[model samples]
Target: MNVGEWAGLVAAAGSILGGGGWFVSRATRDAARATAAATEAAARANAAPAQQQASLAVLEATVKRVDEENGSLRGKMSRLEAVLRAFAWTTDRWSQQMHRAGIEPEPPHPLVEEYNRTGV
Candidate 1:
């Protein structure tokens, strides 16, 4: 082939190779980005269950604490009710004694009357 023709052929081959190299480089970069994204997704997937378990543990502990507090409150309420009942019994006895002595006892509070009516 003539030198000019040979040069032209070499130029054409170089252009094609350069274009192919650019495409290959671009594809490699895209593949790297895809791999990084997949790795991040896998890491998140692995962590999710652990996070959920931790949250569940916190919830369970909270519920247990609430149950314990409720039990304590119930005991306190029972004692308070017993004391209130004793007070009511004593008040009734006092009112009866006053009546027997021909003295008028002060009237019970309206709220006390309502509680007595409702038995609540």
Candidate 2:
């Protein structure tokens, strides 16, 4: 072949080699990205159970705390009810004794009348 033909052949061969190298490089990058994504997905999958256990533990602790608060509230309510019962008995006895002694008892205020009508 002449020199010009030889040069053209060399240029063509170089372009083919470069195109093949570019394709290989692109394929390698895509494969690497896919591998990294799969690895991240696997890690997340492995951690899911532990994350669920942690959430469950938090829920259990909250339930236990609410149960304890309810127990304390119940005790407080029981004490208040006992005090109210004692007060009612004392007031009834005092009024009866005052009436027997011929002394009139003071009338209840309007607010006290409403409380007596309503449970409040």
Best by lDDT: 1
Q: What alpha-carbon RMSD in Å does predicted model 1 have with respect to the real structure?
A: 2.4
The superposed Cα distance between candidate 2 and the true structure at residue 77, in angstroms, equals 1.3
lDDT of 1 by residue, 17-64 (tens): 999999999999999999999999999999999999999999999999
| TM-score (all chains, Cα) for each model | 0.78, 0.79
Worst 10 residues of 1 by lDDT: 111-120
| C-alpha lDDT (0 to 100) for residue 4 of candidate 1 | 100
Number of the top-ranking candidate, with TM-score as the measure:
2
lDDT tens readout by residue for model 2, 8-112: 999999999999999999999999999999999999999999999999999999999999999999999999978876876687689899999999999867765
Report every candidate's CA lDDT. 0.94, 0.91
TM-score of 1: 0.78
